[model samples]
Target: MSDKDVAEDRAANADMRSAFDTSAAGPRPPSEITGHYSSDNPDMVQFVDADGNRLETTEANAPYAQIVEDMTSQDAREIYRDLVLVRRIDAEGHALQRQGELGLWPSLLGQEAAQVGAGRALKPQDYAFPGYREHGVAWCKGVPPENLLGMYRGVNHGGWNSNENNFHLYTIVIGNQMLHATGYAMGVQTDGDVATGDPERDTAVMAFTGDGGTAQGDYNEALVFASVAAAPVVFFVQNNQWAISEPNEKQFTIPPYQRSRGFGIPGVLVDGNDPLATYAVSVAALDRARSGQGPTLIEAYTYRMGAHTTSDDPTKYRSDAEVEIWREKDPIKRMRGFMEERGHAEPDFFDEIDAEADEIAARIRHACQTMPDPPQEAMFDHIYAEPHPVTERERAEFVEYQESFVQEGAH
Candidate 1:
C-alpha cells in the first residue's frame, strides 16, 4: 500500500474510535437546569431571599423558624463571623495553590454557610465525618486554617488529630466518609451512647458529602446501614448544583435530600446560602438524631462559585451567567444583611470582624509559604503506631542507602 493511503486509513480509524474513547474527551457540564436557585422548588426551606429580605415563615419553613427564633443576636453574629473568616481562608488557600505554594485546592467559597451552620449546630461530644471541601466545618471544629492546608501543601496527611475535636480527618476518597460516619454511629449505638435522657451523654454523628459523592455505592450503603441499624446519624449533602463540572441534573432528577425517603429516613431541603436557615435545619436534624429518632437527610441547595479546584477550569463547562446568578445569593452577603437588619451588631463590629478575617488570611498565606516539607522518615515513622518489623526494616534500609552514598562521596 502507498504511504499516503496508509496515512489516510489510520486518520479515519482514529476519528472513528475517538467517539467511544472516554479518556480522550474532557468533562462536559450539564445544560443549564433552571429552578434550584430560584423559588421554583416549593419544598426548599428558605428564611432569607437573594436580596436579603426576610421571608414570612411558611408551614414548610416553620421548623427552621422555630429553631432560629431561639437563637440570640450574639449567636447570629458568631455564625456570620465564621462565614466571613471561612471565605477569607478559602481565598487564601486558592491563592496559595495558584502561586505554586500548594499542590492543589478545593475551594468551599459559596458553601461556607452550609458547612458552618451544620458545624456550629453540633455539640463537642458529637462526631463529624467530612469530605475534602469541608474546610469551614474544620474551622468551626477548632482546626486551624493552616492545619487544613497541610494536606494540599504535601507537608502532612492531616495535621489535626481527628479524635481530639470529634472531627475525622478529611477523606479524599469521595463518599467513603459516609460509610465511616455510619459505622461510627453504629459504634456509638453499640456503646450505649444513644437513648440517654441526658442530652450531654447522647452523641450523634454527622456525615458530610458533596453532590458528586451521592453517586457512590458507599454512600447508598451507608444510608442502608443507618436505616436498618437506626443509627443516630445525619447525612448532610451539600448539593452545590454542580459536582465539579457535572451538574446535579446529571446525577439525578430529584434532589438528594428526597432520596432519603426511599431509605425510610426523613429528608429536609434548606437554603444553603442563608446561614440562618441552614443553622435552623441543621439544629433540627441533629436534635432529632440526638433524641434517638434515627437518621435524617439534609440537602443544602447551594452553588459552587469557584472552580472545582485549582486544577480545574470551570469556564469550559459552565457559563458565566450561571455563576453570576449564584453570586447574588452569597452566604456571607446574606448573613451580613440579616445581622444589619436585626441590629445584631454595629458597623464598627463588622469592621473589627473584617480586620480579624484579614489577619487570618494573611496568617494562612504565611503558613503555607513557610511550611516545612515532611522529612524523608515521616513516611515510615507514622505508618505503624506500634513498631512493626516491616516498616522498621524499610526505614533502616533507607537510612543505610543514604549513609552509603554519603560515605562513598566523602573526600
Candidate 2:
C-alpha cells in the first residue's frame, strides 16, 4: 500500500477498536437511551412544597423521603421554636449593628431550618465547627445567644469556651473549619472513641460552610483527608443559592453533592428548607460516622433569603423575584403546616410561640444596649494561657499612656 493508504488503514482500525471496546463493560444491562435536558424534572425529591403541601415520592425519592418522614411532632415544634428565636435574635443583632452597638452581624434569617435541623441532630459528644453565621447552631448547642453576639459586637474574640459547648469558635475564613473538623475526627479515631457497636460512646464531627466555600483549596483538601483517613466527619454544605450575589449555577455545573464522588464519599442533596429532611440526613450521616464509616457530604438545597451579611446589599445583584421564590419554601412555614395537620400543635400553640418570640426580641434589644464594653485590659488577659512578661509590660505601658492623655481642666 502507498504511505497515505497505510495511514488511512491505521486510522480506520483505531476507529473500529474504539467502537467495539469491551473494557467498559459491566454487569448492568443496557436500555434504549432517551435523552432530554429540561429543568422541569418532576422526579426531584421534595417532601414539602413551598406552599406547605406534603409531597409523595417513589423509590427515586426514597433517600430524601426518609429525611422527611423522620420528622416527629416534637421535632416539628422544637424546629419551629429554634427558627423563631434565632430570627428574633438575628433581627436584634442587625438593629444593634445599625445603632453602632455591634461592629457587624450576619443574619441567619433564611437558614433557620438548615441550622436547627442539623444542630439538633447532633449528639452531646459530637463536636461542631461552624462558619461565622451559625448563631442558630450555637443556640442549639446550648451556647448562650449573647455568646455569639459578643463576638460580632467586638467585645470578645469568641464568647464561649469550645470545650464547654462542644462548639468551636466561629471560623471567619471560609473553609478553614473543614481542616479543623477533620483533625478533630482524626483525634476521635486516635482515642478509639468510635462505636464498636456502643451507641453512647460513639462520636462524630460536623463542619459547616457555604457554596462559595466549596471552591476553596482547604475544602477540597479536607475532603481528601477525611476520605483517606475514614474520619468520622460530615461536611455539611448549605448551598443557599447565593454566596454574596453569586448564584449556585455560577459556581457549579452539577450540584455540590456530586463533588463527593471524586473523594470516594457518598453525597446527598436534601431540601434544606424541610426541617424533617435536614434532620433525617444529618442524623443518619452522624450515625454512620460513629459506626466507623467515612465522611459524607450533604448539600442542603436551600436559598439565602437575606443578604450575605449586614454589609451586603443583595438587591444590587439579585432580583426580588429570586428572593420571593425561596420565601415560598420557608422551612418554618412547612413545619408549621405539618404540625397543624398532625394535631401536634394548635393555633394557640403558635400564638404562644409568637408571644415568646416577642419576648426574645425584647430581651435581645435590652442585652444589646446594656452589654458593657470590655475593658482594654481584658484584651491582654486572654492572649495567652499563662502570663508573659512582655505582654504585662505592654499592658502597663498602654494604661500609662491612657492616663497621660487625661483631660486637663485643673483638678
Candidate 3:
C-alpha cells in the first residue's frame, strides 16, 4: 500500500496494455489475401476467374450450371446490356450528388452483376425487399431509373408502390428488409402461392442485404423465422467486403454464407462479379424457394469500388492498391470479355451499348435537373397509412409558416 507497491502495479498494467495494442503488433495481413476461405474451398461456385476466362463447371457449380448452359447468345448480350446500363446509371447518380443535385447517393459501382443477375432471376409473381443501394435491382423490376432519385432529390420518401412493381421501397435501416422479406414470404406461403408446381402461380421473395447487415440482430431473427416456417425466400448477402469503414473481417470470423447453415438453411457462395455465376446461382436458389424447399442464403463475393456513399471517404481506411486489385476484376468488363470470346458479342455491339448508356446517362441528368421539389408541407405525407391529427396539424403549421415568410417578403 505504499508508493513502491503502486509503481510496480503501474508497470505491470503498462505491459498488459502494450501486449494488447494492435498498432504495436505490426501490420496484419490483408483480409482479401489472408482470409479468403472461398479460394481454398472447392465447393465455392465460380464460373469465371478474375482475368475473364471461363472455368469448367465443377461439382461445386453443378447445381447452378444448368441454367447458365441454357442461356443463349441473346441472353448473354442482354445481361451485358443491363450490366453496362446500370453502371452508367450508378455513375450518373454519383455525378449528380457531386454536383449538389442530390442530398446523397449510394453508388453500386462494382456490385452491378450481383444486383442484375439476381434481379433478372425473379419472376413477375416474386417480391423483392431491397436495401437502399439496390438501383440495379430496381432497373430489373421495371422501375424507372429516375424513380430512385426521388428520395435523394428530396421529392418523396419512396417513389413507387411495392405491390405495383413487386419491389419493395428501399429500407434505410440495415437488416430491416430481411425481416420484411421473411414476413412477406410467410404471407405468400399462408396464401398458398408457393409450391403450386405451376411456375406462373408460384411465388418467392428475395431479401437483399449487405455484409454488414448480416451482423444485425434483425437478420438473424429473420433467418430463425424463415427456417421454422420454411418460407419461400432467398437471403442475398452482397458481401462487398466492407460495411462502410469496417472490413468484413472486423464483422465476423466466418463467411456470411457459411453462417446460413447454422439456421438450417442451405448456403451458397458465388462470384458476385461474374454475372453468369450470379444468375445461375440465383436461379437455383429461387427455384428451390418456389419449390417449397425453404429459404437459401447466397453470399455474393464482391468489392465496393467506390465510397460506401457520397458522405464517405474510402481513401482514409483502405489502400489504393486494394482498390486497384478489385478494379481488374470489374464485373461488367468480365462479362463483356466472356461475350466477345464466345462470339456472342462484337465490337459493334459494345459500341452500340456505349451509345445507349450515354443516352441513358443524359436522360437521367436531365430528369434529375427537372425534378420538382416537394413543398415543405409534403414532408408530413406518408408518415401514416391513415390520416393522423398530429401530422395534419404539422402540415397546416408548415404551410402557415411558409405563408408568413411570403407575407414578410422573405425569399
- TM-score per model over all chains: 0.90, 0.86, 0.91
Q: List, residue by residue over 137-223, the lDDT tens digit for candidate 2.
A: 898999988777778877786888999989999999999999999999999999999977777789999999999889888999999
Each model's lDDT: 0.86, 0.79, 0.88
Model 1, 8-53: lDDT tens per residue?
A: 7577446434422335355433222544435656678989877667
Q: lDDT per residue, candidate 3, 202-242, as tens digits?
A: 99999999999999999999999999999999999999988
TM-score of 1: 0.90
* Most accurate candidate by TM-score: 3
Worst 10 residues of 2 by lDDT: 30-39
Give the runs in model 1 whose Cα sits over 4 Å from its true position.
1-32
| Candidate 3 lDDT for residue 320 | 87
| Candidate 2 segments whose C-alpha is farther than 4 A from its true place | 1-45, 64-71, 407-411
Residue pairs that clash (backbone atoms under 3 angstroms), model 2: none
